[model samples]
Target: MAQVQVQEDPDREERITMEAIVDAYGSEEQAMGWYYYLDDKITFPFQAKCIQARKVSPLKLGEVVEVTAMAPADDCEREMFVLIRWVDRELAVPLVQLEGIDVDDETEEAIADWHYWMARGYELG
Candidate 1:
């Protein structure tokens, strides 16, 4: 029998993360009000209002989840929200819970900088 080897790209996870960010924020230019996930939580520069999903299920501690921003329906109260999706479950969280990263420079720069470190497997300490 012959053996076949499969190797995964080192930057695959980072690329996926960046893609999700782009999808949620609709381009780096419009990402000023967007947030990034770090340390198992979303953070922002200033204090702001946020909403949490009505239902929360038990989740693994270090699982990687994809997040997306969703616009509220016509009848909804808030203007925007986020959807956190994982293996087999999804949760809705208010935009306030997410903290904006780039308050000074343009969001594009922030995204590029973030992707640079993340692609190299950098983690916050």
Candidate 2:
């Protein structure tokens, strides 16, 4: 069976740990419940905590962020949309077209590809 590995964020200097979980997946106090860590543990309108990426170091750095969520389709990739969220340093930095999805190598790769394509002078032949 494939095992899910958890790692730390690296964007910041200090070590930041985030236990990623989906609120709707299981009940609270289940040790694995998404809401257990998210529900009231930290206040909303906070900084973004985790980012979706592929094959990244477990100790990556990210801020604790809160965003408004919207229901997603069954076949759709993301489960929620980040309407408004704050960063530790940046206040109310607008994240347009932001959708929440499971973090993995593919997600990271896709994000990198998009960034690569968006950069100047980078194009497919």
Candidate 3:
């Protein structure tokens, strides 16, 4: 992907506001356009939903997270709540990258609930 040059925000050093990001979003619809762009890039069993973070915290790998979603797949279009399991980072990794390899339906459902997997983390053995 080609890098786009952007001017830094005045108030925050490394962080940029949503308005600024929207401004850079081009002429696309402001509401749900971001999710559409992501949905095009990544194929999921269902559509992707844009989850606005109430609090921004770095996500951990190998952790199960429940993401409310819409269908991005060709066959499916109905909005549904989807849970995803994240994989841990490997030896050499970078910031903001989660090593998640999408799994089959059975495994995907099993991962949606983290509490059950906490004790069975070694069950794969």
Top candidate by lDDT: 1
Per-residue alpha-carbon lDDT of model 2 for 1-125, expressed as tens digits? 12323232243112111333323343222222322332223233322344433232121235334454321222112211223433343222212222224434443333332232223222111
Top candidate on TM-score is: 1
Model 1 lDDT, residue 62, Cα = 37
Clashing pairs in 3: 46-71, 46-72, 47-70, 47-71, 47-72, 62-87
* Whole-structure CA lDDT of model 1: 0.36
Task: Give the per-residue lDDT of model 1 (tens digit) for 1-125.
Answer: 11322333456445535643444434332232233332113322322222222233233433333454342332113222446564676565434233343333343343334434433543322
Q: What global local distance difference test value does model 3 have? A: 0.28
lDDT of each residue in 1-125, candidate 3, tens digit only? 22323333344321122321244344233223333433333334332222222122234434434332332332112111123333443121111122224545433332222112222231111
Where is the poorest 10-residue window by lDDT in model 2?
Answer: 71-80
In candidate 1 the C-alpha lDDT for residue 83 amounts to 60
Q: Estimate TM-scores for all models.
A: 0.26, 0.24, 0.24
C-alpha root-mean-square deviation, candidate 3: 16.8
Per-candidate total of colliding backbone pairs: 2, 17, 6
Model 1 TM-score on a 0 to 1 scale: 0.26
Local accuracy by lDDT, each model: 0.36, 0.29, 0.28
